[model samples]
Target: MEYIILVITFTLFIIIAKDLAHHKKKNPVLK
Candidate 1:
């Protein structure tokens, strides 16, 4: 159970990071 939770959290973190990077590329003014 603990291992499953860890994998979920890690996946969410990577997804969020990619989203932020994409937004930055789309809108340089925001950065």
Candidate 2:
């Protein structure tokens, strides 16, 4: 379903954002 796909995409986006934030905090070079 479209809604399910949307939820999946949103979840993936949040996960990626969290990972990027964690990486930035871990490595100052990205900041």
Candidate 3:
């Protein structure tokens, strides 16, 4: 159960990171 939770959290982090990267690319001012 703990391993499943960790995997889910890691997946969420990757998704958020990708979104942040895309957002930064769209708005240079964010950098």
Q: Cα RMSD to native, each candidate?
A: 0.8, 1.0, 0.8
What candidate 2 gets wrong by more than 4 Å, as runs, is: none
TM-score of each: 0.85, 0.89, 0.89
- Which digits, one per residue and each the tens of the lDDT, describe model 1 over residues 1-31? 6999999999999999999999999999997
Give the winner by lDDT: 1 or 3. 1
1-31, model 2: which lDDT tens digit per residue? 7999999999999999999999999998876
lDDT of 1: 0.97
Give the top-scoring candidate (lDDT). Answer: 1
Least well predicted 10-residue stretch by lDDT in candidate 1: 22-31
lDDT of 3 at 20: 98
- What is candidate 3's lDDT per residue for 1-31, written digit by digit as tens? 6999999999999999999999999998987
**lDDT against the true structure, each candidate:** 0.97, 0.95, 0.96
> What clash count does candidate 2 reach?
0
Q: Which residue ranges in model 3 land beyond 4 Å of their true spot?
A: none
Preferred candidate (lDDT higher): 2 or 3: 3
